[model samples]
Target: MRARFEKQLLTLHQELIEMGSLCEEIILKTFKAIEKEQLPNTKTIATLSEEIEQMEQDIESRCLKILLRQQPVAKDLRTVSSALKMVYDLKRIGTQAYEVSEIVAQGHIVKSKELHVLQSMVDSVREMVTMSIDAFVHEDEALALKVIAKDEEVDENFDTIKVLLVECFASKSLDIEHAIDLLMVSKYIERIGDHAVNIAKWVLYAITGQLDIDGGE
Candidate 1:
């Protein structure tokens, strides 16, 4: 029975990794859509989002089953509870990617000088998503801490994009409507970064039994 329970936990971890990989897929697709100045194929992004949402439900169900059947105590309970919380972050990341792709469908995410900043932010966010999952997979608190620290870079990148867009607006150098759309994309990417940080925080909680109360761990 113990071995069977352990296998179930292992399967849960693998499913979480698959969900993380899907986030990687859609984020890369969204960035490429921006670079090409074209609408992202909504069908593709939607499929990914649906899969992610389904995984969240499945994982939550499995966690409940493990809790009720195995009655996991101590660290095992912490791990299962943390998985439940982590799925929320992963689901939100998928939702944000869907929003980004929808903006692409709107035909307004045109070529912009500020796109390079947006690309950099997306890259940072992608890294955060990947590394945060790695921290979970490896149970490495130090790696989890690094993922938390990296959120600052993503935040600064978003701020730079905002300032540049404001300057463009003030100088009458950019279309107001398109610039607004671009800001929306930047904001979505920023929120994705926040979700990545949240995942790392949960990973930390799983390992350490607590999150950094002040985000200073």
Candidate 2:
């Protein structure tokens, strides 16, 4: 019975990794679409989104099964609960990527200095998402903490974009619609980083047997 329970836990872990990888792919492709000023490849994004949703459902079902059949306790219970939370975070990240793709499809292209800043910000968050998941898979508390710490950088870049966007709106130098779309794009990227932080928190919970709301606790 113990061996069977461990096997189920491993299955859950693998499914989480698959879902995280799909979300990362969507984020990278969405940024590529933005950089090229082309409509994002929605077909791929849609397919991945569907796959992620299915994975979330599968993970939830398996977690419930484990709770009922095995009655997981202590660290095992934390692992199952953390897996549930991580799937939700991954699903939100996927949604944010889809939102960005929709903005790209609307023919909004942010150019010049602002575009560079936005691209850099996207790249940072993408890296964070990848690192946070990797840390969880490897059970590396240090890497998980690093993911949480990097949120500040994402926030700073987001602030810079907001200021530039406000100035553009005030000066009437850029199309207001375009500016708002770009602002939303920045916001989506920032939210992605926030989701990555949430994943890091889950990783910590799985490892330390404690929950930290502030991430530093």
Candidate 3:
């Protein structure tokens, strides 16, 4: 029974990795669509988000099954419980990516220097999500801590964008509607970064039995 349970845990880990890869693909597509001054493909992003939702449910069920049938103890129990917690963060990341895509579809691209700044933030968050998943898969607490620290850069980017938008408003230089839409997009991206940090924190918990590193950006 223990051997079977160990196999199940490995399987769960692989599924989570696959789900994380899908999310990275979705975000990549969304970002490229915007860079080309094209409306994001909402239908495609939505489809990916739906797939993530299903994966989350499936993984959660698998975790619960192992907990009930195997009654995992000690480190095994922590691993299973951490899997449960991380799924929620992963689901939110997918949802936020979809939300950003939706906003991009609604937005008519604003020609501003601020757009480039926002793109940097988008890139940072993307890296965070990727690294967080990698940390979990490899059980690398140091890498996980690095992911947690990267959130600060995301937060800085968000604040800089907000300040730039406000300056545009004060100078009467940008469309209010376009500025608001971009602001919303940046906010979604920030939230996605927060979720990534949450995932890394759970990874830390799984490995070190510590939960204090989730101090937020």
Candidate 4:
């Protein structure tokens, strides 16, 4: 029974890695679509998001089966439960990426200095998402902590974008519609970072069996 349970856990970890990779792909596609002024087939992004949702459902079912059949306890139970929680965050990240693509499809293209900062946020959050999944698979609390810490950079970028947008408004430079679209894009990216932080916290819980990560709420 223990051997079989261990195999199941490994499968779960691999599935998560696959899901995380998909999320990363969509995120990059969304941002690149805007940056390059060429919206990548919105249909493709939407399909990726749908695939992520289906993956989440499969993972949730697998976790429940493990819980009912194997009756995992202590760290084992935490690991399964954490995977369950992490899927929701991953699903949200995927959906948000799709939404950003929709906004981009509507001709929301931020350029120049603002685009540079947005790209930085995208890079940081994308790293956080990847590292959070790695931390979970390896059960590395230290790496998970690093993922949580990276949220600060994402937040700062959002704030900087907000300030820049405000300046645009004050200077009567950027039109209101364009400025609002840019702000929404920055906000979605910030939320993606938050989801990554949540995944990292769940990773810590799976390892230490304690969900006491600061700023995780």
lDDT of each: 0.87, 0.85, 0.87, 0.91
* Per-residue accuracy of model 1 over 13-98 as CA lDDT, tens digit each: 99999999999998988778888867789899989999999999999999999999999987888888988988888998998899
Candidate 3 per-residue lDDT over residues 42-64, each given as its tens digit: 99999999999999999999999
Question: Total clashing residue pairs per candidate?
Answer: 0, 0, 0, 0
> Model 2 Cα RMSD, Å?
2.4
> Which pairs clash (backbone N, Cα, C closer than 3 Å) in model 4?
none
Residue ranges of candidate 4 with Cα displaced over 4 Å = 213-217
* lDDT of each residue in 97-201, candidate 2, tens digit only: 887888878886756677888999988898898898888878899999999899999999999988988788788477877888888888889888988999999
* Model 1 regions lying over 4 Å from their true place: 212-217
Candidate 2: worst-modelled 10 consecutive residues by lDDT? 208-217
RMSDs, each prediction?
A: 2.4, 2.4, 1.7, 1.6
Of the two candidates 2 and 3, the one with more favorable TM-score, higher being better, is 3
Runs of candidate 3 with Cα error greater than 4 angstroms are: 213-217
Tell me how far the alpha carbon of residue 30 in candidate 1 is from the true structure, in angstroms, after superposition: 1.6
Q: Give each model a TM-score.
A: 0.95, 0.93, 0.95, 0.96
Error of 2 at 202 (Å): 1.1
Selected candidate, larger lDDT, 1 vs 2: 1
